[model samples]
Target: MTPDEISTYEETLGVLGDIDHRVVERVLREAGWSPCGAGDWAVALRAPDGRAAARISPFDLVAPYTVALYREAAHTRQVPRLFAHRRLVGGGDLQIMEWLEPVDADEAAGFHRALAAREPEVAELADVVRRVHERGRRDQPWFAPKLDDNPDNIMRNADGRLVAADLFGADGPRLYAAVVDDPHLVVTTIPEPERRFMTDIPLTNTGPWPPEVRAAMHESLTTADTTHQA
Candidate 1:
């Protein structure tokens, strides 16, 4: 989108407030986001020390939502480090987050193996998912599984642990609960792009899950369906 259009979209998404456009222009200029691109937002800067990346968004409130959920997920260690959140004086929201390298296919495969192995550390993943579910039950927000589960959003630390990155989607709380209640249901129904992205690592088939996991998944799906009906 054009820069002006991007500004408009940011306003629509509540990323921007009714302030002088010059303020936003200044931030963009200082941040080196002058070289604009199509998407509703732009990556403004990579932190001087290279610890975080600052991004600006105009369309779809994904980034801000992601920041919000990431903050919540951080409490339970379901997500990586979140640096900062700020509203631009002119327009749009700025999200600064710790920079993380995307997980590659091979790495993703390893993560899958770790999950399947059910090692003690793997329990952390389940705990993260469970925390998300508890938060979802309490908040009832729309959740986007793809964003949460995509390999691109997964990261590895120096210690070689898998951590979630992005968070933007629908209601955070509701979606988190749905995932915990029915892990496979959402993953299975995801569109082709997301499905392909997530399925790159071959996890066990949900059709024949371990009894406890299966029961939990069924319960999640049922809760989601019932929520929709109500």
Candidate 2:
């Protein structure tokens, strides 16, 4: 997508004001979006067109860094093509982008291990990773990931390129559980005016949100900062 198109998408999304977190999924389902499966930190939905998808976090997570990374790396093909990103009116952020199918973890891990062996394709993957890493180190504080161990982070685009996906935000699940348990934390944790926008939003997840998760949230929220703009 062009830069102008991205800006337009951002504007269009902002106009969808005040989406309560409680009915967010139901809303998407009713709008004809289909489940594209979920990961530990967030869930995803594919648009009716099937070529595009959206990733939703109960609260903002990696979209800030990921979107910026993709924009900067647009010429490199190492990351997914991001189309649009905007914070939900209630809480969290929504990221729409080109949908990619994930490669099997074992297969991805094996390919990663073969980097040193210099197989042409593996070497290409290593080159791409290095480029994205260099950009991340230079521009993003939230871009850290243990790529060597996490093979599930690898995905293949429609063109068969092994691309990196969800390269940050390991703290997502714990933070989400905490928010789900005590929705008021949305007011206390996320900084000012943004929290005010979600005052009436309720979480849909029913939980045995363990005490440790809440504890983790309290500890992290002190330093919590999530951004919607790239």
Candidate 3:
């Protein structure tokens, strides 16, 4: 791999820590995703045009979980529909989902302003979150969402409907905790199911505000005794 490839591949490793590196390489080879871009949390790959994307990450449960969270998970009419997923088969998880267009720049900017302000708090987060956990299990429910409500995730097309985009991100567990920690991220509520769930599970998967989020991310990604991040 070239330096660029190595850099992106390392970001992939950052998201899939604990999994053997060789296995991840094989999975990527078989999956045949054309590389898009990657950051600290995960790597982005897409199938040929007109096909859904398949993102590989450490968060095995989030994809199916998101599918179940949204009421219209089946229809891609409004949001990106998760077509399928592989739950950590061979030490890696693959999420197959609809390819959504980028959110409108103006609309995204407006939403970002709202995020920075945490204005007009929405109470719906509790319900939405509850639904995700409820459907996240094999016997019961499903989940898709990047924890951060970065306006980039909320997109729209010609029809003016909200397009659920950028449903991939950094560490799954940390992302979850970040959402729970911030009342402004999604919705605010005193009663908490995820909080209780987090405590109940001994070993389970687990932010910061906009500008602060980046800083905190840098802090977490910082490697000791080295200027580079992991």
Candidate 4:
């Protein structure tokens, strides 16, 4: 990215004013967005042409370190694409990302069943988490903050594979402890009971796995390191 682009991005985020509806609109408009909906510090918007979805936030600056870590994760594809990160002109941080489509009830149910079955899907998720951790370790060597690792952060794409999202955290590593540590996990963000079942085993952990899962996790970390190095 050019210095000018970076400067403009930062300026736009800095203009958010006070993290309210008015500020959200101003920031979105400055960033070329059309308002859709909003939550507390976060606001949803569509690209000018309506070809993509985006979200703006003032919360990113609340924990700048964690936000940097998330940007690193995005670079490694350990998380979703990060379209933009900047300080609004009024005085807040903003992040724009590719809006992901919602996972359907049937698909959500299948994901739940697959996770419960402890089949290959859970293993795959474990691998993804491992990659995320590895990326965090290398990019932010002194700070290896744990991800939320909740169902809401995990989205399924057109091919029916899970992708992780949401990059903010309350603290270093235990943001969403329940989902990460639970042996029987279900992502409750989506309404469908069947699709809600994510993985039977919590994919985020320190170690001591069943050999295979552990191995995959190790590989993910190693690959992440090597890829970044290259």
List, residue by residue over 36-152, the lDDT tens digit for candidate 3.
644333455676553455566533334445555444433434455555544453223555565556766787766545434544532243334434444443232213332446666
| Candidate 4, run of 10 with poorest lDDT | 190-199
Please, what are the lDDT tens digits per residue for candidate 1 over residues 122-230?
6665455545544544443234443244455567643455666553344434533546856545544432222221211112222223568646654665565566556
| Candidate ordering by TM-score (highest first) | 2, 1, 3, 4
Better of 1 and 2 by TM-score: 2
Give candidate 4 misplaced runs (Cα > 4 Å).
Answer: 1-24, 30-32, 61-71, 74-78, 89-91, 105-150, 156-161, 171-230
Candidate 3's TM-score: 0.44
- lDDT per residue for candidate 2 within 113-184, as digits (tens), equals 765365675565455555665665455333354443468767788888877666554343443555556444
lDDT of each: 0.47, 0.60, 0.44, 0.46
- Each model's number of backbone clashes? 12, 0, 13, 17
Once model 3 is optimally superposed onto the true structure by TM-score, how far is the C-alpha of residue 184 displaced, in angstroms? Answer: 30
The most accurate candidate by lDDT is 2
TM-score winner: 2
lDDT of 2: 0.60
Give the TM-score of each candidate.
Answer: 0.45, 0.61, 0.44, 0.43
Segments in model 1 whose C-alpha atoms lie over 4 Å from true places? 1-29, 32-44, 59-69, 72-78, 87-93, 112-119, 133-142, 145-147, 157-161, 171-230
- Could you tell which candidate, 1 or 3, scores higher by lDDT? 1
Q: Which of the two, 1 or 4, has more TM-score?
A: 1
